[model samples]
Target: MTVRPASVDDLPAIADIYAHYVATSVATFELDVPDRDEWQRRHAAIAAARLPFVVTERDGAVAGYAYCAPWKARPAYRATVEDSVYVAPSAVGTGCGAELLPALLDMSRAVGVRQVIAVIADSGDEASVRLHRRFGFRDAGRLERVGYKHDRWIDTVLMQWSA
Candidate 1:
């Protein structure tokens, strides 16, 4: 597998990966899957902000993706960002996330990001939490039952990494 920056052409695969999580799991709280156009806009926005948006390819197909976006809109949060990492169902155990996340964080650091926050849904899957922890992220806090989706209340685990 190879990890590299994502391009416009990779959005469809990225969207598909995210859509699966949205439709079948509480990993993301998104109720509706964003279309290709929305993904395009997001790519443009992340590019314009000079942030890192990456993808992992296995056998010439996008196997996973990772990116960092401003944690908040306020100017005070400029130095901090939130990270999102998703791996394709088929590639989940293939070390795709393991490759993509480190690349994302290293690029974020190169671009002057001082802190990275991971707001992960507590979906009873500890893989994400363990992955973040392996990359030096620490438990910051948890917001109990902050999200309601799929007819159930869910909590969010906030993890933090500082450079």
Candidate 2:
């Protein structure tokens, strides 16, 4: 597998991966999948901020993607960012996330990010939490019943990693 900065061409695959999670799981609170135009706009915003947006390729196909966006719009939060990672269903156990996350973090550090936060939905799947922990993230806190999705109430687990 190879990890590299993502390009416009990778958005469709990235959208697909995210769509799967949005449709089948509570990993994301998004009820409707964003369209191509939205993805393009998001990519542009991240790029404009000089943030990291990357993809992992296995056999020349996008296996997973990760990116960091400003945690908040206020200037006080400029050095802090929130991360998101998603892997293709077929690549879940293939180490795509393992590769994508570290690359994202490294790039974030290189670009002067001081703190990275992951707001993971408590979807009963501990894989995301475990993965973040494995990469040195610490439990920050949890917000109970903050999100309503899929006909159920869900919580969010906050994890933090500081440079």
Candidate 2 displacement at residue 45 in angstroms: 0.3
Q: Write one digit per residue (lDDT tens) for candidate 2, span 60-104.
A: 999999999999999999999999999999988989889988999
For candidate 2, give the lDDT of residue 163: 87
State residue 99's C-alpha deviation in candidate 2, in Å: 0.3
TM-score of 1: 0.99
What would the per-residue lDDT of candidate 1 be over residues 86-145, giving only the tens digit for each residue? 999999899988998899999999999999999999989899999999999999999999
Per-model TM-score versus the true fold: 0.99, 0.99
- What are the Cα lDDT values of the candidates? 0.96, 0.95
Residue pairs in clash, model 2: none
Q: What are the per-model numbers of colliding residue pairs? A: 0, 0
